[model samples]
Target: SFVASGTFSRVFLVHPETAKTRRWKEKSHDAQRYAAKVMRENDSYIQYTSDARKEGDILKRLEASQIAQGKEVLTMRCFDSFAVVDEVGEPYWCLVLEWLG
Candidate 1:
């Protein structure tokens, strides 16, 4: 479900099983979940989209900087990103990151 909203996007907390539409009636498994920051598709998307990408880029730079100094970033670790087109043909940019909790 939705966790929060930022200047340009909303965040959703999702589990590994959330990827599939149908749930399996089996034993539960331990897996990593993620916090997805999805870009807002609005009238200002043309400008906000770039800013949204910059957010991920900044996170990567911070982690890279810490790694270069022999340190580890324990928060907001970005995993992957992609664009999902909606029924209205609007492209929503998404950034998948490590969920802190």
Candidate 2:
């Protein structure tokens, strides 16, 4: 379900929302896309518990700060939910984000 190697631990290609997820915009589903950045602790020698939660907190803070400062540098939006990918070796923790392109 996830494609990763070397620098990337996990990467997911997401299409625009269907009936499963609510549509954020009025654009055609096929014309829009999204991305999921899966962060894993297995790559490092020191693994930390609640890896997903920590990362989510950091991202949320970043979004909040950017909004507060009125900065437009960050284009993509980070969602709150973490998508759990049932892979072979370990479960991949992912943050579903708006595709940056």
Candidate 3:
């Protein structure tokens, strides 16, 4: 389920497959963690959720512009896959993200 707090819907951490499968740097490397920001679909604050989606779009635009200009600006990747989660009998709108360590 997604959470609605302030301007953010929900935030979580996930370990990307690449991070887990890649060989670590032995004693020099710490476990990598990724941060995910999820947009809320059901909430009392409609503007907040709308802003959340807008934020995602902004990030996407930045990434696109950077790529077109041959520059790297965004450090994290975001996706647009509609997520529906069932917690008990209630369904929730959630966004799954990779943890940013």
Candidate 4:
């Protein structure tokens, strides 16, 4: 897992390798990065979830094409999804995205 984090979801800084074997680095604010919009399953607002799903679908299609073309895709180019049990043990799905900066 790459450094995972977001405002709505609990962000974890994950490395591609095992957590113990990987080093953590903070992203520089001045660096160029991609922005990925992720879905927050626990969002009280239903509209947000709907919009996220729509965006995720569109992004997946675009990423598939880019990957096929051998283009340089940013981390944000691909959307990673996960589901976790909240403190109450309720399942929540989160979308991990690259920050466009």
Q: Give each model a TM-score.
A: 0.70, 0.58, 0.51, 0.44
For model 1, residues 34-90, the per-residue Cα lDDT tens digits are 998888433254454345566677888888888889887854777777777768987
RMSD of 2: 5.9
Question: Where does candidate 3 have its weakest 10-residue lDDT segment?
Answer: 1-10
Give the TM-score (vs. native) of candidate 3.
0.51
The best candidate by lDDT is 1
lDDT of 3 by residue, 41-73 (tens): 545455433544555566677778888999976
Rank candidates by lDDT, best first: 1, 2, 3, 4
Cα lDDT, model 4, residue 89:
78
Lowest-sum lDDT 10-residue window in model 2: 41-50
Off-target runs (Cα >4 Å) in candidate 4 are: 1-10, 16-39, 42-55, 69-71, 98-101
In TM-score terms, candidate 1 sits at 0.70
Candidate number with the higher lDDT (1 or 4)? 1
Ranking by TM-score: 1, 2, 3, 4
Give one digit per residue, the lDDT tens place, for model 4 in 27-97: 44454343333335545444433444544566777888788899876435445665556678776665555
Candidate 4 lDDT (Cα, 0 to 1) = 0.52
Q: In terms of TM-score, which candidate is stronger, 1 or 4?
A: 1
**Residues 1-101 of candidate 2: C-alpha lDDT, one tens digit per residue:** 34444353456777645564456746564666656777663344445344555666777788888889998747457674464656576666677777665
> Which is better, 2 or 3, measured by lDDT?
2
